[model samples]
Target: MKIATYNVNGVNGRLPVLLRWLDESAPDVVCLQELKAPQDKFPEEAIRNAGYNAIWHGQKSWNGVAILARGTDTEIKEVRRELPGDETDEHSRYLEAVVNGVLIGCLYLPNGNPAPGPKFDYKLSWFERLITHAAKLYTLDIPVVLTGDYNVMPTEQDVYKPERWLDDALFRPETRAAFQKLVAQGWTDALRKLYPDETIYTFWDYFRNAYGRNAGLRIDHFLLNPKLVGRLTTAGVDRHVRGWEKTSDHAPVWIQLKEK
Candidate 1:
C-alpha cells in the first residue's frame, strides 16, 4: 500500500491543489498537517467526494492533523487525538488511527522560530512529550507509521544550506538531537534509509526563489517501527506539487509498503 504525508498549509485556501494531488497520487493512506482551520471548518464533503474517509483534529488558524484512508474496504479507526504526557496542551497537532491494521500517527510539530524564547521552549517541551509517547508506541510490536511535517532538520543533509540554518530553530543542535533521540527508539527513517546519499527535500520557502533554486529542506518525514521497516518498498517526494499555483511550500512525501 502507498502511504503519504502532506502539510496542506491551509486546507480551505489550497483545496483545489489538494484535490488535484489526491486524484493524481491516489495514496491508500494519507497523513495531513497544518489544516489551519477549526474542526467545524474542515471540508469533509469535498474530501469525501475525493474518495477518502478522514478523521481530523483541527485548531483555529493554526496547527491541525488528519488521517485519511482511501476506499471502503479499509478498516479505519481513531485511536488517539492528542499525545500523551500533556493534559494542558491543547494544540491540534497529533492524531493517531489504525488503518487496515497499521497504526498511523500524523503530526504537525511546532515551528519554534526565534529561538531562546518561550516558543522555542514550548517546542523542546513538545519534543520531550513526543519522545516519551513514541517510546510507548515502540513497545507495541505492531506495524506503525509515524509520519508528518516534523518541522526540524534532523541532519545537515536535510537542509539546503546547513551553515545558513545552523542557528535556526529547525536546524538547531537541540532540535536535531531531539529527533535523533526519537529515531534511536528503533524507528527507521524511511527516506534516509532508501536514499542515504541523495539530497532530498520536502519543503521549499516561497521567498528568494527557493523552489526555483531547489533550495529546500527535508522536514517532513516518515518513521517506521521495526515491524513496518521490512515492508518498506519505495519512498519519494512529489517535488513538482510544490510548484503548483497557490500551492503549499511543502510537497507530498510518500512511501510504499509490501502487502501483508
Candidate 2:
C-alpha cells in the first residue's frame, strides 16, 4: 500500500492543487495537515467526488488534521482525534485511524516561533505529550505509521543552512532533542532509512525564492514502528507539486509498503 502525508497549508485555498495531486499520485492512504478551516467548512463532498473518504479535525483559520482513504472499499476506522495527556489543549492537530490494518497517526505539530516564549514552551510541552503517547503506540505490537508535518528539523542535514536556523524554534537544540527522543523509541524515519545520505527536503518557504534556490527543510516525516519497518520498500517527495500554482509550501511525501 502507498501511504502519504502532506501539509496542505489551507485545504480550501489549495483544493485544486490537492485534487490534482490526488489524481496523479493515487496513494491508497493520505494524511493531511494544516486544513486551516473549521469543521463545518471542510469540503467533504469535493473530496468524496475525488474518490476518497476522509475524517478530519478542523479549527478556525489555524491547525487541523485529517486522514483520507481512497475508494469506498477502504476502511478508515477512527481511533482518536486528539493527542492524549492534554485536556485543555484544544488544537486540532492530531488525528488517528486504522486503515487496512495499519494504525495511521496524522499530526501537525506546533510551529513554535519566537523562541523562549509561551508559544515555544507550548511547543515543547506538546512534544512531551507526543513522546508519552508515542511510547505507548510503540508497545502496541501492531503495524503503525506516525506521519505528518512535525515542524522541526531533526538534524542539521534536514535544513538547508543549519547554522542560520539554529536560533529558530524548529531547529533549536531542544526541539531536535525532543524529536530524537521520540525516534529513540525504535521508530524508523522512513525517508532517512531509505536514503541515508541524500539531501531530501519536503518543505520550502515562499519568501526569497526559497524553492527556486532549493532552500528547503525536511520537516514533514513518516515514522514506522518496528512491525512495519520491513515492509517499507520505497519513499519519496513529490517536489513538483510545490511548484504548482497556489500550492502548499509542503510537498507530498510518501512510502510504499510491500504486502505481507
Candidate 3:
C-alpha cells in the first residue's frame, strides 16, 4: 500500500492542484495538513468526487488536518484536537486514523519562528505532549506511520543552507534534540532510512524562488515505528509536484509498504 502526506496550504484555493496530484499519484491513503478552511467549507463534495473518503479537523483560516482514503472510508482510531498541555485550543494540528490496519497520524506542528517567546515555549511543550503520546503508541506493538509537515529540520544535512536555519526554531538544538528523542524511542525516518545520502526535500519557500533554485528543506516526513520499518519497501519525495501552478510550499512525501 502507498501512504503519502501533503500540506495543500489551503483546501479550497488549491483544490485543482490537489485533484491533479491525486489522479497522478494515486496513493492509497493521504494525510493532509493546513486545510485553512472551516469544517463546513471543506469542499467535501469535490474531494469525494475525486474518489476519496475524508475525515477532517478544520478551523477558520489557520491550522487544520485531514486524512483521505481511496476507494473506502477509513477507520478513524482517534482525533487529538487538543494536546495534553494545551489548555487553550490554539491550533488544529493533529489527527489520526487506521487505514487498512495501519495506524496513521497527520500533523502540522507549530512554525514557532521568532523563537524565545511564548509561541516557542508552546512548541516545546507541544513536543513534550507528542512524545508522551508517541510513547503510548510505541507500546502498542502495531505498525504506526506518522506523517506531515513536521516544521522541523532533523539534521544539518536535511536543509540546503544549514547556517541560514541554525538560529531558527526548526533547527535549533532544542528542537532537533526533541525530535531525536522521539526517533530514539523506535521511530524510523522513512525517507532518510532509505536514502541516507540523498538530499530529498519536500518543502521549499515561495520567497526567493526557492523551488526554482532547489533551495529546500526536508521538513515534511513520514516516520514509521520499528514494527512498520520492515514493511517499508520504498520512500521518496515527489518534488515535481512543487512546480505545479499555484502549488503549495510543500510537495508530497510518500512511502510504499509490503503487503501483510
Per-candidate local distance difference test: 0.93, 0.95, 0.87
Tens-digit per-residue lDDT, 81-163, candidate 1: 99988899999999999998899999899999899788899899999999999999999978998999999999888888789
Task: Tell how far residue 7 is off in model 1, in angstroms.
Answer: 0.3
> Residue by residue across 23-117, what tens digits does model 2's lDDT show?
99999999999999999999899999999999999997779999999995677999999999989999999999999899999999999999979
TM-score of each: 0.98, 0.99, 0.96
Clashing pairs in 3: none
Give me candidate 2's TM-score against the actual structure. Answer: 0.99
The predictions' CA RMSDs to the true structure, in order, are 0.8, 0.7, 1.3
Q: What's the CA error at residue 77 for candidate 1, in Å?
A: 0.5
- Sort by lDDT, best first: 2, 1, 3
Candidate 1 minimal-lDDT segment of 10 residues: 67-76
Candidate 2: minimum summed lDDT over ten consecutive residues — where? 66-75
